[model samples]
Target: MAMAFNSDSELFPMVNVNNAKLSIEEERRENVDEENRRKDLPINECMGEKDANLDAIIARYAETINKYNLRNLGYPTNQDFNYDKLAPLFHFHLNNAGDPFVGSSFSLNSSPFEVSVLDWFANLWNIDNSEYWGYVTTGGSEGNLHGILVGREQFPDGILYTSQESHYSIFKIARMYRMHCVKVGSLFSGEIDCVQLEASLLSHKDKPAIINLNIGTTMKGGIDDLDLVIQTLKKCGFTRDRFYIHCDGALFGIMLPFIKQALKVSFKKPIGSVTISGHKFLGCPSPCGVVITRLKYMSAISRDVGIIASRDATITGSRCGHAPIFLWYALKKRGLIGLENEVHECIMKAHYLLNLLRDAGIGAMLNEFSNIVVFERPLDDDFNRSWNLACSGNIAHVVVLQHVSVEMLDTFVHEFIEKRSIWSKDEQFKPLCIANDVGSKNCACLMHTTYHITFSFLSTFVTYPTTHSCSPPPAATSITVLRRLQPQILPPPPSSPSKDSDLTTVVLMPTLRSTTVVATVAVVAAILTLSLLGIYYLCLTLL
Candidate 1:
């Protein structure tokens, strides 16, 4: 019988397979080494000729900024935007200070000035008491990761619980620590469901549990009820010590002090630890986050893990000195009253947009607690008719719908509507004739189109033009050609006029004028075309 062939048979029968594999791996290592050598080349040597190219990239960006109407936003285009004030506060030279890899070196130590500032931040969040303690991190994600790590350290076998709409980082942190995560459903009012949370806890009663409560969720800006969550935990016989509660207050922590006063609730509470991101509402350019835990729990994990002192409690080694400094500066600059005022303004702006949508008869959903508001465009009879027309002809009509919640929505909707209006008017002016004119036959087509376009434009105009000088000027009318055919029957208006008042009377004036102008323009165009054709024919004959 012929020798049996196997899929794993080596092509290099003369050489050792293991050695061959090792040789190839060595070659790959050499290639990587070569790449590293090339990368290590000095910037000036490697990119000498590309300096102009780099400058051109920035120039092109600037040109694009000019071409598009994006000049009003206070974003910096060059490097000269007040770097002196911000640069010294950064820990960019921390590694250069001393021998970074050494054990317990004084040069590698963190700034005591930074630690004092962090202490202030902890106090600001109501974590200064003997029962509470916390330290700064690079960002909310890192802070959350540290929080979960602490949770896993305390309750090694616990399942991490959070809302379905919680930040993705929560689940990621859980996975990083090899912990099981249980997501509970959210409420209709855009909050974590207390009942579902209770059920989740009961279902996972066999395992130690850690609840990751989000103060401000990414989507819908939903806030989980901490009071209810605490109550449910108590009902399940899970005390603060038995089950850790990590409050991910990244976006909302800075605002809590202000909001708490309005709600008449103390910020100091039952949660074991809370994480905060300074960049979201704190208006910081660099990343800065803090994790606040009870003093007992903090003390338990205070042992230094390498360069970071044991008591540091942060996830990373050699923490950035600037984070705590920035946090301290932000807290001091914007005191409790200032933060409350800013949050109040944001809420007011959000409510303004909600009111505008309501006044415009546009259906929308507004979150009562937080500043976020979400709403879809109303599919009214007029909108449906226009949409149907576009769909029937296979023309991709842009959906004039949006979803937003909070004060940010007000600004977004306003800008969106303004840009949409300009584009809509531009589209209307284009004389592209559709093959099927089903919905085009309606007498109210022009009016309805104009009305919708104007409505969208008005919405945008209100929001965007508030701080900017560049406002969309009035629309200019353009002449468009239409086929001459017998007038089609028009649909009756939804709300009929009074019996005494004639609907026909008011409609005839504009209808007649429009018809006359359209006819006159068409006749003129036809005459011009015929004249040109006659002249061309005569010239051909003469030749």
Candidate 2:
């Protein structure tokens, strides 16, 4: 039951959800590996004479995970972590069902570690313990649920406002809570359009606003301008008490605080709450997230649960006590310096991947201060599934996490280029233009291919006058977009000039005038010395 439709829309000429699911099921059925299925393993059914062969099964599973981890780039989960030291603790079952600050009667709980983790986040977000209340949830989705629920409880009649590019969970939360949701538009970068928001806010000026601002969007890794969003709310006559902001920093939440000049997400700002994924930038063995909000809003959400002998405000009952310890270990080990270094490393690797993609004539985009690198989706489904690429419409993204290395990125790019060439040659296919998706400057499709020749950062171009006097270079009619090519690897750890000394800057021009070079030989020979005299000044304008 497969249907094929054709159109220019990104959503069209694609696999339908229902058929895709059926296709996956059929594929799995047809390609079932009997050896890998552990069909011979026997489970001990209630005192029956059967051996589970648990050891062999566990070893097989471990091997499979190790193999999968190498190619797992579609998701943002960080695979570079270890919690082997806490293996003994896994023997006991633990649950922190109630509020972390208020310890529960369950003595087996790891509430102490949980509280410490929450405090660290609160302090990180610039909130005093007395003024803040938070808890570790299952993962980012729960954190979002908790944050938005707190907002709804605080302002019961508030209308939910979120951009079209927001995580799918936001709309689900809206539906779950039965709140009137206002879907706002977004810019090409996926940031919420402040103008559209202002218009929406003005249209519904009476209802209180519960804005879910994206610290980093899902696909494009776009960070909604928090400052601009706040400004728009105020300009639209929504005052301090009239609105609430919940910063969904799922991808960049914890990472942004470390990056220089990155938009600061803090309690000091008028933001009501902030949520970040523990397994994202801050890698964890388990799925978890933290959500912190103002203490003033606690009374409306929190309540004394007689059964648990503690306040039950969190979205779930019996939260994973093990998750908090895992988070604590990661934060403790990384500290500030280690975490900062990891974030910086991921972003640099992303840049390296982007450079590789573009250099190979494949269109790609990497956001400023984001680790997610977006590119044109591959035509071959097998090639896409082999690397486990996360795709939407005509675009696909590879979230370069701490585990993603230069070697792996190189391998991925090489394979992509090779496979892409084959696919295009076979079909005589034209590369898709993603100007509407990313931007004109980043697109490499046929219509926009000439733009690449307009300006490249790798070549040095000299515009010389035939006369012996210095002449002003004639300006081109079209504007050229300038791009930088930073070093593949950054300088080695903290406080050293040795690394900086090894670096050199090279000017690359995409194209040069077709003028004669015979007259410039006198200039080319003496030009090295003469160029140095004016190179600094000339570069200012030419670059």
RMSD list, candidates in order: 17.4, 12.7
The 0-to-1 C-alpha lDDT of every candidate, in the order given, reads: 0.55, 0.80
- The TM-scores of all predictions, comma-separated, are 0.56, 0.77
Best candidate according to TM-score? 2
- lDDT digits (tens) for residues 37-69 of candidate 1: 533423234355744555655565556544322
Q: lDDT (0-100) at residue 446 of candidate 2?
A: 54
lDDT of 1 at 392: 21
| lDDT accuracy of residue 236 in candidate 1 | 86
Question: How much does candidate 1 score in TM-score?
Answer: 0.56
C-alpha lDDT of candidate 2 relative to the true structure: 0.80
For 322-389, candidate 2 gives per-residue lDDT tens digits of 98999999999989999899989999999999999999988888898999999888877767877778
